[model samples]
Target: MKNQEGHDNSMNTLNRTTVSLLTCVVLFASFAYAQGEYGANDFRIKVDARGQVASFHDAVHRRERLVPTQPAPLVAVKKGDKTEEPSRAEFEKEPPLIRLHYEDCGVSLDIAVQETESHVSFEIIRAEPSDKVDAVIWGTVSCDHQQDGG
Candidate 1:
């Protein structure tokens, strides 16, 4: 009986390990495929499945734009308990009115990025309603650079 019990425990452990490994592999694959890029004339943006503007480039301006200061979107949940934002995401679709999903609090954040020749828009739609929903934009800051007078 003792030997049988030991075998059962070992099997349980093995099963858990296998499940965890598979989950990691699946998550990695989803994020890998979820990333996308789009361009409307001179303006272009790269988006990750985790609902972040990974990078933005303006070719006509001759310089890149927007550094990612936050690892992911700022969010606050139930009782102000912050949920761990997903670092990667599963892509919903491709360019020009692209959609991305971020899983949190038993709900999915359906983020949409729409673009036109000269305009861009973003919206976050909740798949399931919950009181624990708070998302904030990571904005941009400008600084004036100067040098010592000659």
Candidate 2:
């Protein structure tokens, strides 16, 4: 009788362990699905230029451009917390171009600028999945450097 009781208790413990593992798996799957949905959302780009040539390396990429001191409308998309605005020195080195590269959940973005007396243009490119290698984004910047007496 004692042996039988021990066996039954062991069996119940095993059953509970299996159920717990299954629950964990289900929760993990749901989390992954949510992340995928969020990633699929669109992102936007907004550039504020100082009306001069600027150069700055993004955390992940490198670029150069010329831009004006004023801000310009570049692109519209989803917003992310990781995005950062370029510094004055960075903008002066290039022509107001922003490049974003994502791989294995890692992201690298570069912003450059071009400046003119009358106008400035900015570009932004993004690669998605962010954690994977299947996403890619590209674009360009247009500025009126002629007006800046360049």
The lDDT leader among the candidates is: 1
Off by over 4 Å in 2: 1-7, 34-150
lDDT, candidate 2, 43-89, per-residue tens = 21233332122222121222222243534323222234342222221
Model 1 C-alpha lDDT per residue in residues 1-150, reported as the tens digit of each score = 226556667677789999999999976654456666766777776766665667677666645665546443422223255654444445534433433333445544455667678866666555345454554333332222233253
lDDT of 1 at 105: 53
Evaluated with TM-score, which candidate comes out highest?
A: 1
Total backbone collisions for each predicted model: 0, 44
For each candidate, what TM-score against the reference?
0.51, 0.23
Taken over the whole model, the C-alpha lDDT of each candidate is 0.53, 0.34
